[model samples]
Target: MHPDDLSAAAEVHRLAFVRQKQSEQWLASTLAAFPRFLCFVAEEAGQVLGFILWAQKSGFRDQAVLELDQLAVLPAAQGRGIGRRLIVQSLPLVREQLVRQGSSLKHVIVNTRADNHAQKLYRDTLGAQVEATIRDLYSADEVFMVARQVDEGARGR
Candidate 1:
């Protein structure tokens, strides 16, 4: 996603995640600061519909993991599998970047409200399994999930 889409992307988050509202300026600047962040937007005829942003962790090298930093789909765009498409489409790009760095994509991680039904979506779409839980991590319990895609390579650690 480019800086031009930040405002619309922020609007999507505000509408989709009614519980959280972040300034578009902050979101755009934060994304800019993360060179390794991979962001994608679902667009139609020049209008933004949704977006997903992921960033590498653990120093972005061997054994590094990816965190789904944020995802949002416009209220009108939900229930249409936009989120699923974002993940599916971003994987090959992520893999290409890792290969370019001579590194491997080690794991995929995401966090969400423990009671949220979207857990199923993350599990089914991303192969992520709840690996940890923290009470009152936010307004409710938060779950950290992982899809262990590079277990053999990760074993080096």
Candidate 2:
């Protein structure tokens, strides 16, 4: 996402994640993190409908583990495959950035509410499987899903 898209992306975040406050500030900080935190927006007709945040976990290495930090879509724009597209399209871009840094993606990890239907999307898109579940974590039970050996999966597309 470009710097100019921050406000619009922040609005999506605000609407998608109503429990989260300071949308603009949160997104701005994540954007400033740059290579450590790769942020991408899904837009159509010059409007940001959604965004995804992928973060490099731990320190830099020859192999990188990425966290699907956040995914948000405006309420009005939900169920349109925008979130799925963000994952499918931006992942290659993320891999390119990792390649430039002498690292290849090794794994992707995601933590989401256990009851969230997005788990199916993660499974279908990233080959992610639930490895653990933390009870009463962040508004509900949180499941940690991992897609291992992802570099061998063509960016998990």
Candidate 3:
């Protein structure tokens, strides 16, 4: 997303997370440095209803692991499969980037609030596995759950 889209994107982010205002400068800077970091929006009649931003990074211990940095859909648009569509579109981008970098991606990892209903959509609906649970990682009262998508060839193993 560009600096111009920050206002709209921030609005979506604010509605989704109920947190501090997202910085336009930060988004612009990050997008400039990493163009592959995607910000996808669901728009109808020229109005953006929701968005999902995601970035892929090599894991610290395993270079073959691709970590999803962020994913969120506006609260008003939730439960309509917009989030799932974003994730589904992102899988190929992740695979393409890995191939271009000559890396063999073995899995995709995402982190979400442990009690979040979205967790079931990602885990049960999308077939992601809970890889780990980090207590109080984001806040004193919140727990973080790491979910993983193993490559098709590694699914049964």
lDDT winner? 2
TM value for model 2: 0.95
Each candidate's TM vs. the true structure? Answer: 0.88, 0.95, 0.73
**Which regions of candidate 2 deviate over 4 angstroms?**
151-157
Residue 64 accuracy (lDDT) in model 2: 94
> Which rank order by lDDT, best down to worst?
2, 1, 3
Whole-model Cα lDDT per candidate?
0.78, 0.91, 0.59
Report the poorest 10 consecutive residues by lDDT, candidate 3: 148-157
- Give one clash count per candidate, in the order shown: 0, 0, 0
By summed lDDT, the worst window of 10 consecutive residues in model 1 runs over 148-157
Whole-structure CA lDDT of model 3: 0.59
Best by TM-score: 2
Q: Write the per-residue lDDT of candidate 2 for residues 1-157, one digit (tens) a residue.
A: 8789999999998888888899999999999999999999998999999999999999888999999999988889998988889998888999999999999999999999999999998998898999999999888999999998764433333
Winner by lDDT between candidate 3 and candidate 1? 1
Write the residue-wise lDDT of candidate 1 on 47-99 in tens digits: 89998888888686775688887777888888888788887777777777778
